[model samples]
Structure formats: structure tokens, C-alpha cells
Target: MRYLIMAEGEGDGELLLGRCAAVEGLFTDPPPPPREVLVLRGCAPGVRAEWLGAASVVGRTESGFEVWWTLVDAEVLSVAPHTGNPALVDVTIGAGVLPDDWHRHADGPFVRFELTTGRGAVRAVTRSATDGLVADRAAAEPLPLRLVGCEPAEPMRAALRKRRGRHPGYTELWSLDDTGRVMDRRAIGFDAEWTRPSVLGGALVDVLLSVDADGLPGLAARPAWRLWRAGPPQRAGSWRELDAAGRHAWLMLAMRRERPAGPDRSGGEYHLAGAGLRDEPGLHCAIGEALLGPGGYYGWGWDALFDSLCGGFGLVPPFTLVWHDFAATERELAGEHDPAAGPGYPEELARELEERGVTVLRA
Candidate 1:
């Protein structure tokens, strides 16, 4: 039998019927196809639809209307009502914390409650009833995947340079040893047309790769422009609207989302659609790993040999960069090196990171 909840106050009768029981209740006939109605004295607008399906909701209206509703499982006032089955709850709370009066039974870490028990009983009833429907639907496509600790090498540098022009105020140069280790690690040392080096570490000879920016933000912003010229434009974010922090946030979220598979053989192992990195022919680079911290997140691109180093090191690597500024620390450069910069704790830091499954490539 259906449970009809008639409000003792104004508006709640219509409001409850409008919200919980119907999808198009606002304008439907016969009060929007009644399922089970629970009338109350007062009303609460915040009480959601899911809550209605499970158990009673405590709510009040602006005019001092208050009410709660629950399906009836037992006999009530000579009325045909759906029996409101009592709920049972068993929860684990932290030790040493004072037990709240809301729980009926609290022994050690576990607390148990029956639906007809008291106040919490109704909430528990509603929660259990709606759990399946609410939990089944997945959340929105996650924030995009982000590339962290991205360093530009020869191919990326040449690719952007060929796509754009000689960028001033930017430096892009780096080297990888025969074993894929970054060698004589230093930020790129050069003068492009549109940028200038605010800081300098001089240039290295055996440059395996280089890029204009020391961090991923700069790399991400410029790629869109280059990609457009390379062929039909792809869907990379824009440069003009986003700054370093904004770019980093956007890229990090973007990289984590699932996208179509990459056409290239090298990046095809992970189901591209199921993978975080967006798969597009125009993708100029791949993020190998990422780090997160209070300052924020940063991304990095790795070379072809990067996969090997990660694999050899027994790492499931997060994003592409060999190194990164995951916490957004304001250092001289993104991943700048200083042999004599004083060993505050570089060796220890490196060891800790490696132990945590990171392949810390030395500069």
C-alpha cells in the first residue's frame, strides 16, 4: 500500500510532491504520477530526491512548516501504508574519541543501530534504499590528465621551432646519456626572438634536447600554436588566456582523463581510450610522471628512452617528465641543477623519491 504524507502546513504538500516523487512533477497532471507520498508539518528544500526514496527527511519551510515521511511496513492509524522497515547500522569510528549520543550501541570501534531506533534510523533507511542508484552512475569525466616535470629535448625543441619561429627570451636545450640519463643537467641556454633568459646556466655541448621553457606550462601553451601550423588544428588549450599556474592546472586535469588511443606504436600499449593522455596524431609529446603538493601540480615530457628507464627502474610512472616541480616551489628554474649549490639534502631526497617508486633521474 502507498504511504500518503500530507503536510500539516502550506506549500510542503506541493513542494514534496514536486521534488522527490516525480521527475517532471512541476507541471504534470494527477500530481505527477504518485508513487508514495509522505506529508509533514514543515518542509526542507534541501532534502534531495534520493533521500525521499529511502526514508524520512526533516525539513522546514519559510512559513514554519515542518514534516518527515517514511514508507510504512506495519499497521498505522487504520490506513493502508507501506511498512517502513527499520534500518540497521554498523560503523567504525576512531578510538579515544568520545562516543556521540546519536549512536545506540558503541562497543570498541563499532556502533550498531536499528531503523526504528531513533533519529539516525531514518537517515540510515534512506541511505540504504538509494545507495544502488546513486552509486551506479559514475562521476563526470575526470579533470584532464596533467604532464609534470616536463623537460624539452631536441625533437620537441625542433618541432616547436619548425612550427613556430626562433622564440626569443626562451631557452630549450638538454642532453640524455646512452642510458637515457639527463647529462650535465642545465636549463636551455639560448636567445629566441620573443623571449629572454631571466636566469642563465650557460649551454652544454652534447645537447640531446632543449625547449624554451623550464616548466610544463610554457611548453603546453606554445604547442597549440605549433600544432595548428603543422596541419589541421587539434584541441590543445590556448596560451593567451592561461598563465603558468592556470596552464598547469588545466593540463594536469586534462592528462588524467580517458581519451582515444594514440596512433603511434610506442604509446599504444595502454588502451588510449582508457589511458589518461589524450590520443591525437598532433600530440608532440607524452607526459611520463607527475607529482602533487601544496603549491600545486606541474607536468613534464619525457623522451623515447624515458619509458625504458621507468620500466628498468620498476616504476609504473605517473606522467612523462624525468623531473618536475609538482609542488610549484619558486626555484630559479623548473629542474635546474647546481653541483656546488650545497648538498642540503639532495642525495637523501633522491633516495626517498626512488624508494617511493619514482625513477629519480640525476642531472
Candidate 2:
């Protein structure tokens, strides 16, 4: 049987499966997944995971034939399955949740199996993993995430409050040429994206897809968390305070006004894939980081390089740079301009982001 694995783009599309190959007994010893599984790109070839080392298989797991990659564009992923129609199987992959073959990793594995199929020939199955593969990188502690049932806007509201009480309050309005706009704001919730500053000129913060050596999945869950200096903050409960929203809002707003909204804003469906900032190449566009405008803006200082790689890797379509918001404040600014800025930032931080490989728009 020919198994088809569909994805937004052909290049990086295989990453989802590649990770599955990394496990010790997965693709090799025990033949982790059925060796017959096939993979394909669901979107246009020119527009896939061409950057951010899209082809790199950074992490893997044993139990579910399940794998991991950097946060994937949940929006693009929604349509990907339909585009290629993984003939015998119709499984959906996205953020936070595990795929069919995950339970094998459990200490006290559950007992249940689910399989189904739509119009396609392949079958979609969800079951408990009896024998799972274990990859070296899949070692990060399971995320200690808490879900809150509330309007997405509420997190941003709380983030703003935190930013207000913090130092270097939101007083100025930084602008990106036309790409987007941002302001001084912050909030906290489940994801780092809660109360995220305006991004892609109000397009909304799109979840970033990433996989690191730590074996943890990272996303811009909340806009508020986008500006956090550390990983997901430590807040417990449905209604609690998060952290600062960061300081790129004003700079972002300045950029948005300079440009117009993007073309692929909507697919006219209630499902999220069609609305807000569409994927572009060589540029990582986020909603609240005051990042990326009509051309491209640099608001997600940390995500800048990764996004660039995402764009370059073809996960997103190609775009141009219209503006770059350069601001770190008087005291926040690096003491001196070390030509080797990229090297200074930790490798685990953004990897080779600052190296000469990427293109940054200078003020």
C-alpha cells in the first residue's frame, strides 16, 4: 500500500516523519513505524519548509511513531492534509497534542485504539503505543502548561497590565515601515502569546513551530509571553498574572502603518487557516511582536533569525523587508557593538541567527 504524508510544502514537509526516524528503535531496530509509510508535500513546492533547517530532524519519540519539529504553522497544517490526502491515513498533526503513536512513551501507558478514514483510501488511527521508539533528544520535561477558557484577547489585557507596572513603561510608539505596528504592552496566560503586542501589522500572533535539542515543543502560545526573557513563565491557575509583554509594540505600530494588509488574510472559513497573516517565504511574520509589515519588519528580535530561516526554508512564501524596528533602550542596549553579535547570543537561543547568513533591515 502506498502511504501518502501531506504537508504545506515539500522541502520541510518530511520533517514530521524525519523526527520519527530519529528514535532508537523507531525506523531502524524495530522498524518504529511501518516502513511502508510514504510522505508528500501538500502545498506548492516553492512554498514549504525551506528555511529554519526545515529538513533537519531535530527530535523524535518512540511510543506513537510520533515525531517533533519546531512549532509548525498550525494554520497551514490544517489544509495540508487535504491537499495531499494521505490516502490510507487521515491523521491531523499540530501544536500541543500528540499524534497516534505517542502512548508508547508513557510510563503507565493507556489502553485504547482508534482508527478511521474519510473519503480517502488510507485509514486514520489513534491508539495506545505498545512498543515506542525513544530518540535521544526527546528528553525535555513534559511542558507544564495550563489551559484557561477565555477569549484570546483576555491574555493580552493581562499582559498590558504587567508591562505598565514594570520598568521602561509603554510611553513611546515605535513604528515599522508598512509591515505592522507594535506598542509597549505585556500580559500572561497559558502561552507566551497571550496579550501579544501587535504583529504583522495586527495580523495576530501566529504560533511559531520549533524543535530544539531539549526535546520540547515551543510555540508563541500567548502574545504576552513573546517578550518574556525566559521560557514559559511560572504561573498557576485559570485566572492569574503572567509577565511583561516586551517593548516592541510602539516600534511595530510604526511599521504597520507604513504598509497595507497582506493578500492571503482569509480563506473565508471559520477555521483559522484562512484568516490573518498568511505564510510568506524567507520571513517569519508574527502578529504581536510588531514584526513584519507589507514587506518585512523585525520586531521579534529573538525569533527574527528563526523566522528568517522559516521563510528561507520555504515553510512560508518569500517576502521583502520594508522596515526593521531597532530598539533596545538606553540601558538595555548592548554595551558595545560587537561585530560578532550573532555569536554572542547563545546557540540554543536563536542558533545561527546573527551570523552573516541572514539579512536584517538596518534603520
Candidate 3:
């Protein structure tokens, strides 16, 4: 994979310098550092200078395989893969200069990089003129120029305002082959550890199915629980009035039914006791707090629910969950309440549970 960067203006070079330096730290394992740094000048007409270097470090990071380099004050920086042999040049490009799209809107100031792992391949090409970057892969793809983790550089952030909210709010774990092609990709959420191939593919599928036609996943609403007096408030016609244990039991049953019958089926039973009703009131509030934890996935909205059901919170399927006070639980869910309690909470829960074939039973 060849990465090219081109920068013009006063601070642009300095920015590239910092970014490249950071990348150099990516490869810091057994591989030894580059013994020689090469500098090339006047590579092309109107092109000022270029720098090339090599690092032998190779290892795994929380994200994926780490491989990168630094190019300060250079029009180009070229990188080669760490094959025991040093002759192979895997990446070659000018610092801050990205590749030109098939359509050439301009000829200057771009950033381009390619990453290939065992899971899949990602190629990004962004021209400063356009003000955004586009990264692509087979399974998980983001809206053009949408930054996932930290915010992007200044002008780019301003240009991406319209598309900024489109980020999936999760990181996609990827692995690359020796040749720099991405082989696998997995979508991971907060406080979650990366599992094997199954988790990767499963998470991606869950996201795709839950998202709207525009590919944006459902956004979370308000928190389902609010403190009132010493205990939680019970809205006149809401699921909050239901017995906590009973509601939890129903949710467990619903979860079980929602899954397909197969090897993955849990086939076990879970029980929720109603003893905590004084402290936790509504079904949504109790379940969100108990299962997802305080301020976790509670009342965030559909995406959070889907993510929770998909095991983002560490709960997997195939088991039956039972609760006492089934009738009281049912009444609360079917009751009327303000949207603040999450409008359509019951309907959405029922719809998803019914789809999965999860069954609820009262003891």
C-alpha cells in the first residue's frame, strides 16, 4: 500500500510532520528502526521535495496491525513493508498528498492511504479542495470523510458538518495480511472486547439490519429512568408502573424468542425477582440499569436496544428469562405515557422480540 501526502502553505508541512511522526510510533515491536533516512528533491515539475524512510517494527495493537512512518518537511514519504528482506517498497506517496480521484477537480493538496488486513481492504483518498475523505471496505463502510474516533483537522471538520453525525459511533476491528490487504472486519462498541470471526460478522449484520434505508442506525432517546423523591416516579400510564421483576422476565422471554432456533439458541432460563421495585420502577428503567448498567444503553433509543440484544453489552442468546407478576408487567408496557418515557417503547420491544421468537413466562 502506497500513501501519498501533499501539503502547501505555512503550517501544512508542520501538520503533516506531526501526523507522520505519530504514525511512526505505530510500528514499535521486534522490528528494528530504519538505519538510513532518504531525501529526494524535484521528483516532478512544480514538486518541491520528498523524504523516504523505513521502520521494521511489526505487532498488534488494540485497533489492528500497526504500520506507519514519519515525513517532515518533504513533498513525499515512501514506506516499504517489513518483509525479512528490505527490498520491497509497499507504500510510496508524497507527504499530505492523496491520490487523485478518477475525476480530477484539482491538482494540489491531497492525502491518500491504503490499508489491507486479513479481514478486508480500506482505501482512502481525500483532496483538500473537497474537504472530506472517503474510506471503503467490503463489509463496514462509513459516509465519505466521516471521522470515527477523534475529530479531524480544522478546515476538514467544518466541511464535514453535514456528514459528521453519520458516524456509526463504533470502531471496526480489522486485520491485514502480510501484503497489506484487509482480510477481516468487525464492528465493536464501547466496553466490549473483540471476539473471533463470528462476532465480527454478526455485529456487522446486526447493524446493517437495524439501520434505516439511509444506512444510519437508530439513535437513542432519553434515559428511561429518572429519580423522583426517594424512589423512581411512576408515570400514570406507563411501563414504569409494572413490577420490575415481571418486566425483566418478559424482556428475557422476548429476547429468547427473538433468536432463531439453531445451535446458537441459548435454551436456558433466566429469572428476575421483583424485590428491587422500590428502587427501580419501570421495565425500561430496570432492565436498562440491570442489564446495561447505570447510564449505559438505557433510553438511548433503538440502536442501543439492538446493540444490547446483539451482545454489545456482553449478554448473548439461547436462554429463556422468567419473571413473576407477569400481568402487572404486561399492563405497564401496554399503558399510555409521554414520549419522554420513550414513545413506542412497548411496541418496538414487542416487534423485535417477536421477530427473534423470544418467549416470556410468569412464575
Which RMSD values do the candidates have, in order?
A: 27.6, 23.2, 26.5
- Candidate scoring better on lDDT of 1 and 3: 3
Evaluate model 1: give its lDDT. Answer: 0.26
TM-scores, one per candidate: 0.18, 0.19, 0.24
Q: Tens digits of per-residue lDDT for model 3 on 288-359? A: 544433322233334545566665344545445466554455455443323333434444554565476555
What root-mean-square deviation over C-alphas does model 2 reach?
23.2
Question: Each candidate: what lDDT?
Answer: 0.26, 0.25, 0.30
In model 3, the Cα lDDT at residue 253 comes to 22
Steric clash count of candidate 2: 83
- Cα lDDT over the full model 3: 0.30
* Stretches of candidate 2 exceeding 4 Å from the true structure: 1-317, 324-331, 335-359
lDDT of 1 by residue, 12-73 (tens): 32211100110111111111112332222111122222322223332233344433322322
Best-performing candidate as measured by lDDT: 3
How big is the RMSD of model 1?
27.6
Error of 1 at 14 (Å): 28
Off by over 4 Å in 3: 1-268, 273-281, 290-303, 337-351
Give per-residue CA lDDT, model 2, range 215-320, as digits (tens): 2212212333232213222231111122212123222322232334444231111111112221221112232222322223443445554553453322232322
